[model samples]
Target: MSPLDDEAWEAWSPHELGQRLREATLPWYVAGGWALDIWHGKQTREHEDLEFVVIRNDADHFRAILHELEFFTVKDGTTEYLPPAANLPSDVWQLWGGDMRHGCWRVDMMMEPGTPDLWIYKRDRAIQMARSDAVRVSETGIPYLAPINVMLFKAKHCRKKDQIDFNFLRPRLSLEEKEQLTTWLNELHPGHEWIKKLPIS
Candidate 1:
């Protein structure tokens, strides 16, 4: 059962939900494709699920809120394979699930791995996703994925659906963003050709 009602789901926008997330979990920022859409100023296309990157220690706090929202809790403190698939990679990942006012919504949680570049000192490695400027859901008024991170995360996927998302978002990227992303990619993967090899939707 969901804490929200039909009208509640109808009333909550993505931005409002973002506000809730901010309220519930301080310092856990939204990430992935949705974050990218916020950066780009629009929703480039449809997305299957909402993705977030939270601090590793906050998983328990996030899980508690998910329980309050009536979302199914699968993993308590670790990452693993899940039954359903979304836009993310198949490798082990941690997730929480729930039905909002609408129906089912999945939250993909990636506790920042100790990648050399993910540290706080590596400010250049992160892009700011302003919640104030994110695209709002018509029904719920919550903010969702920003566009640049959407493309970056999709670029990592290199799948047909991801290719489709990229096609929708690529033309909208600013020249400076494109150049910076290209540089970031080259630095992140060193020689990965998936971005170059994938077919645009």
Candidate 2:
């Protein structure tokens, strides 16, 4: 289940997402557990909902492109309909799109911090990476966030699924990626349980 679990979710598959956003020139990438599965070349576990990240400023552009969905701003535990071309409240960084036809939620769109060229950790702006390094395109032509980065975000929320994702991908992470994740966890989530488990080369 997603943040708003009560609603039905007929979320788009990663392939479906790639197909729809294929023409989108702006930076966007599949996120959450799906990203790890893409990197692993298999679905380790069933995903509750689809999630993706895009530049906050380009959200309107995406809304214009994903016509099948009706975007809504999710703020302070409330979900409100967001009109097309409307600016999201500065404080509202999350959105949920519903498919009127199916009467179900489709995707969880995350409006991320920073510019198109640089990927900035919203929680800590000081931590940054080149967009190229942060996003990796799969052989199937789907772009996804780096598994390391995904795990780092997952660390903040220790749900059962999050733990599953972390354990499943942790061993597969390269030594460099592990060190990077370690540094990030130590800095952003000091004394995080995952830190002790991440062994460095």
Candidate 3:
């Protein structure tokens, strides 16, 4: 059972993540808004929660590692308790970890597509990259998903916060990164305004 029996959250910082998963044998990378912040080398905006990813096959492995917390599968605004020994449903990709000791939610465990050695874009599976290129380590020793991958995910949603992230990150993209994003966006989101915003050539 969840400690509080209610939905509440207090996310951990990237530093806390480093301490917790330092010895994890498989790859794990800080994801979502926090990832972008890590790439930018500072907290550029407020984050409502912390998120991280492991290869889909390793989701349960992490759930066991963070034994102090219990995981609940989140799908379309509803959450269901996921028993420790059970497998995550194929359709469920997000798990909210409840901090049993603290009586609040802590982090989100995103079970993204792709193997530990490769990164696949969830929105468009055809877009791929070597996993080494998909992740970057911060100076503080925290691993984070690359900014371009984060931006690609954000572009699909384009919520207010996503727009803010794009605004801040667009100027920082390298010529090659911008070109890559442009090509992918054209294939997946043709006529997207962000396309126009990117450099032409």
Candidate No. with top TM-score: 2
List candidate 3 stretches off by more than 4 Å: 2-7
lDDT of 3 by residue, 117-157 (tens): 88988777888899999999999999999987888888787
Model 2 TM-score is: 0.94
* lDDT tens digits, residue span 47-117, model 2: 87999999999888788889888888888777788876577888999889888776788889998888878
The prediction achieving the highest lDDT against the true structure is 2
Q: CA RMSD for every model?
A: 9.0, 2.7, 1.7
lDDT of 1: 0.49
The list of candidate 1 runs beyond 4 A from truth reads 1-13, 69-93, 99-105, 114-146, 189-201
Query: Residue 100 of model 1: what lDDT?
Result: 50
What does the lDDT read for residue 83 in candidate 1?
Answer: 26
Predictions in order: lDDT: 0.49, 0.87, 0.86
Query: Candidate 2: lDDT over CA atoms?
Result: 0.87
Error of 3 at 46 (Å): 0.5
Candidate 3 clashing pairs, residues 3+ apart or interchain: none
- Relative to the true structure, candidate 3 reaches a TM of 0.93
TM-score, per-candidate, Cα-based: 0.54, 0.94, 0.93
Across 4-123, the per-residue lDDT of candidate 1 in tens digits comes to: 221222223347456657557334555655565555567766656666655455555665665534433234444333323223343334554545544544555555432212322122
Clashing pairs in 2: none
